[model samples]
Target: MDRPVSKVREAKLELYRKKGNIHAKEVTGRFNTLRWGMVWLTQTIFYGLCWINWESAGSVRQAVLFDIAHEKLYLFGLVLWPQDALLLALVLIIAATALFLVTALAGRLFCGFACPQTVYTSIFTWIEARIEGDHLARLRLDAGPMSLRKLLIKTAKHSLWAIVAIWTAVTFVGYFTPIRELLPTVVALKTGPWEAFWLIFYAAFTYVQAGLAREAVCQHMCPYSRFQGVMFDPATSNVAYDRQRGEPRSNRRQAGQTGDCIDCGICVQVCPTGIDIRDGLQYQCINCGLCIDACDQVMEKIGAPLGLIRFASETALVAPEKHRPWYTRPRIGAYAALLLIFCGMGVWTLEHRSLLLVDVLRDRGALLRETAEGEIENAYTLKLMNLSEVPRDFIVRVAGMPGARIVGEERFTAEPGSIRPVSVTVAAPSDSSLSGIQPMLFSIQAADDRSIEVVEKSSFILP
Candidate 1:
């Protein structure tokens, strides 16, 4: 069902990796700092956006609410209706294309830095380290026998994890239901069945994925990790270890020890995914740069130049001076072009999008009737959807027939963000040049603004 996976080169450290529950040693460096920074940034947006309110049609509503009950997606001043589905599709396409472009240029950069799984996993692990002590201490604790102190500590840790997961789920559901109402309903034990189900389901999902699954999700569950190899090339930059400089690792300072590596295994311990970078670009590697940070610190203390492990392409490592340019790669270039085209199309469509939608349905009761003046009459129903944030009056008009004029009300009103159906009647002389199911056009226009108008095609039947 999924793409083929690349095998990781086996080494003696494979035994260490088999140890249950990888406890990644906390490392401090620019990349670690950047990762935490992303964690804060992403969580802030996810948790805070639902609290913002906007004024719409003389009523206050959530600024970014996806009101599925009303089939409306409100984004600040923009109100998208079902007819604007193309915009949603375009946005998804643009996001996927951008991800592919970024992946082709730098393999798994998103998985490393900004993936929700990685971010939440990092948070959960940090909490674990804080409560259970460092990686070595945790290993010791797990191996030790159960005791009162261990039980208390475990209880506290799981309690906090449940709280975080439950709150995360609540914030996610707030996007669909108004958070203001949903919170009160939840506290009052009055939440709807759907709300209760999602709250419990999402909380469990987050707890298991972030607190328990951890690296297993990235290594085995994520399809992106499985398929990312196809996007990489010899020149694609990724977290890599320089075997030329780091091979023949020696633990002791002795003569003929040309390799810079000291066999400290610090890189392996710091890796969240628990895969050695020296394993030659394994699918399990998330390109998180933690190993690079760990290796650089070791390099500095040992008086060796930094970058034993760094973001270097295979071609760059083999021949630094002859690596191909990113722009020259056909696959990367194609991905970049696709991202631009989709983004441009989305912007253009939104800029020219109309605020009025119209549909015509011929009244089945009387497709054709004769007035007392010997005139053929037709009846139609017009469904007008007003997408604006304010209510306004709309004018109706008919065309595509000679001397065909509206006999009933030509002006009607629609509420803001509501659909209104109106019955319209048209009459034409029986001696008209056209007869028998002639094509007709129905147009609806805003009475206040000529620019807001829509024309739909129907038919006028005649005997």
Candidate 2:
């Protein structure tokens, strides 16, 4: 019974929704203005961040790059090795927590204002509007027979879209491959197969997802929309219609008494997702506030109060809900606490991170060899990682067994942020009683700074 009822409702929705074409009518209001502002800010950051270069030890590279080839992530002065994956995990958790907190207070704020799909869709639509004229004009053009003028107009519009999509792809890939280096490789047609593939794939993805998919992505593809309900409470604010204030809807020509709404369909016409705000909240709604802007214009023209459509909570609209401080809310407090804890841990870990790291790899070729002085010698390769921004001299020493000492060069110089491998041979007086592997320790200390040090355990051979 439930399935049948839902299918019937879906059929009704399909009838009401526009077929193929959805050119949202242009609107102007505070929300529209804010949306445009966010579009500019986000696009600027995305396109320009890869070009920022930082210099270290007379070499320059992208400030924020994840050099997968080199197994290092650079964010300005901080370089994270693969072992620092914990910090990256913390960052993801913090971002998710922050999103939850925002959702609990103002629903889908990020999705509407800052999501990549929404941003790119707005950009593409703006371009379409510019090239093809207003929403009405585009509709007319689409409906009319194809002509040379229509062909030329469409060609120009698509060319512009292609340019934007390709460039967006380039900028996105630039974070992994330095933009300066990648541009040359691209121009020379020397990009590797993988890079070329990503370039084409990403370009097509952006073009189709932003220009063609549009609201369909939000309505269907976005898993977040389905799960966002869990993040919402009755007190959660979202773009909604004040049905109590303006309902019993009527046209101007009708009646002795009427509500503020003039039955103007402008809100529906201007909605990107084509869902009427007055129909109540739906998962399809992006909460972009364009409907609010359109309804506000209608109210303004009719000399009615603004905000017939606004960011409002269900509880408040049903019955005036009493507001409380954010700290007083248990859910909000929990979200904040989680965010703070992760952030604190990240900061503390970064601050106290050691400048030197070491690993001891025993040579398997010859575990134990007899020395000329009646001693047993063990060969090893020391992997010393210099995580600091300056060069430092490191001294390696061996301990544990009696008369154990380094047989080869004990001091080595390591450059800033370089991993140096040193061949080390430890020799100790041979003991007839001791056999097989014996416990030993390798100490690596910076010649200038004792604080920068590491002690690693290894096994010494006895014969």
Candidate 3:
């Protein structure tokens, strides 16, 4: 039996539909300038931060290194340990909230302007344009027969892309492993297995995502575009086509027979995701405003007023007079309020965070031991973390039982930015009236600055 003709045709079309690649036309205007400005700003911060030097705890190192080996994070003057993970959690919360607020205020602003994918793709495409001429030239070259010149150009483009990708990977991994140390190892071709693995992995990912995947990553792979509707409202500003003025689009400029769009298709030509804006907003649109830039240029050339396509809200396009200010909208205001609250909480928590942390573990081997002097003994291990920048001596003390006291060394010096585990014996008079499990408090205080303190509670076994 044979399959139906419709089914076979549909299958063939589906297979061939995605055969070609998109070569977005080069556009220059206000939005293009703004996009490049963000690319410069973000890349400067990312690639330059690793090379910045700072002195911490008498050692010079990268200004913002997350020393995973030591389980510590160094950010300029602040040193954070695993125990300070709450601050990191708060930071993440503030970031997520900020993203939500921005999305409510302006749709896909991050994706269009500052997303790593967008930024890197812009860079990759810019390089491609510089080497391969404009979009039409590149498309012709791709469609034409293979030649030595075409092969050389293609190889050169990819070689440059690989260089940029590897550099990006190196900078990314530098945050986890000190760039200074990693650089020498890289030069020597002896990077650690994990470091090399991440560097190659990230490099390959950058190359593929920016060079090969391009718009597919934004349209199909990214979850942000799929659910952006949830964050959008009537007042959320987005790159939109003004249908009232652009409808009845025609190329010929006969008297009263034309719309502002001119039917040129430049907007579709320049779109990174290849969506026609005049058809209305679609999930494939990144809100990049390249179409706006392209349309503005075309309108300027034809002596027509600009803004045939622009950033507008659904309310503004449907009923301009009924549209309200963005910040005035209740949903936007609510998002802003929540964002501010999360930021405030993060700042407040960081401001009041403690410099010392302590954990006490009671020995499970023996509940209680009889001492030679007729005293009840209990063993414990103390894990102390010093989060400050300077070394300090910490004094340990035990309390709660009538005659409870620490028998071992009471004072110990801890190195700056280090965790120390100490074993201590707590002795109480065996003849004391206390029996069963007795509640006890273990306190550690800075010898020099007594105001710095940490207290932990544990049970003292009694026999």
Candidate 4:
């Protein structure tokens, strides 16, 4: 049976509404140069950090490896365990708060410059431009009929994009798996299931998102672009056109034209999201300032003053007297304060965190027992997790009850980044009148390091 007409019509409408071919024309400016510089710096650190090795706990491992199988994260001199998960949470909060602060001060700064989507899209587009020529050339090529030259260009562009995407995926997964060992398996086509799965999945996603989807990810997929308006205030710095000065626009310079705008349309050509800035700030605008750069170039050539389109606050544009410095804005100040607080807490927690952690669980199967020597005994399990990088012997001692002592083992050793479960028995005189349950303290201290210790509380039951 033929497909339903309604379904086909809906599909056609959806495609037409959502799709727009954006071939952002290349422009040379300080902001564009800075964006490219960030791309180079970030990718260099990402792709290179996995291969860098550091001496860690008598063995060489990746400088920044998240060894999930061992429940350890080796970050240069610092080691993190599952117990330190709070630190990770705090770090995430700090990052998110910082993003909010930046967004409040300058609209979508992260989205425009530092976002992975923007960075990778810029790279893919750069490669595409190199292969297919500039904006006009690319448009012409797409509009023309298929030819051998077009086929060669398209094939070469996709092949290079795949190479970069696959490498990016491998480097990302290398943070979890040992890249040194995983590389050999990848080369031999014998990677484990999870490794192969993530590698292929991420590579395909990068190619599709960066090379094919492009601006659609920033426009529709990213929630930040949609909600950034909530963070925006009148004081937020954004790329805006001076409508009062530039309006009454004309394509040609009449004899008595007053407005500065010449209707050149260069700004729209250079926009990554393909939005006209003159229509005012839109959700699709990334605030990358490329339009400002394009407009400034046109103004300079026409002997007109710069800043016809530039970064300025809405309040400054409307009432210049009400304008204030970015830091003086109450919203920006609040977000900055939150970001600092989160960062400070994370640093303080990491500094004062104990190197040893202990958890005591009283044996419920046989809570209390009478010994032949007329003594009351209790069994407990102590879980000693070492959060340090070096192995050490720990001494377990029980207190808070007179004449109470550990019966069997008091000295135990824990390897680096390992959790050891120690079974212990505490015995006290049966006729001591200590009936019911009594609170006791179990202290585990490192044999060599006095600074490393943990105290846990448990109950001593007597019959």
Per-candidate alpha-carbon RMSD to the true structure: 5.2, 5.1, 6.0, 6.7
Model 2 weakest 10-residue run by lDDT: 8-17
Model 4: per-residue Cα lDDT over 1-463, one tens digit each: 1235535544643333334577778998878888888899988888899998998678887889988888888888888888889999998999989888888888888888889999999999999999999987887777778999999999999999999999998898899999998888889999999999999999999999999998999988999888899998999989899997786776555535657887767787788998888889889988888988899999899888899998898998889899999877789889988988998999899999999998899887998999989999999989898888889899999999877899988999998878899999999888656689888899899999998988898888887
Global lDDT of each model?
0.88, 0.87, 0.86, 0.87
Q: What TM-scores do the predictions have? A: 0.94, 0.88, 0.89, 0.92
Each candidate: how many clashes?
0, 0, 0, 0
Q: Number of clashes in model 1? A: 0
Worst 10 residues of 4 by lDDT: 9-18
Give lDDT tens digits, candidate 2, residues 1-463: 4456546655644443666668788999988999999999999999999999999867887999988998889999899987788888888988999999998888899988999999999999999999999987887888889999999999998999999999998898899889998999988989988789999999999999999899999999999999999988888899999998786766642344667776657787788888888889899998899988899888888778899999988877887757555567788888888889989998988877788999899998987899787988889999899987779899998777678899979999998779999899998888777888889999999999998889998889786
Q: Write the per-residue lDDT of candidate 1 for residues 386-444, one digit (tens) a residue.
A: 88988979999889977788997999999888889999999988975677988888888
lDDT per residue (tens digit) for residues 1-463 in model 3? 1235535544533333344778888889999999999999999999999889898668787889998988889888788888788889888888887888888877898999999999999999999999998988887788889999999999999999999999999999999998988888988989999999999999999999999899899989999898889999888889999888876776655556667766767787788887778889888888889999999999899888899899999999999899999767899888888878888888898887788888898887988999889888999989888888889899999887778899979998887888899898999987556789989999899998887998898888888
Answer with 1 or 3, whichever has the higher lDDT: 1
Model 1, position 102: C-alpha lDDT score: 86
> Which regions of candidate 4 deviate over 4 angstroms?
1-20, 254-256, 370-374, 430-433
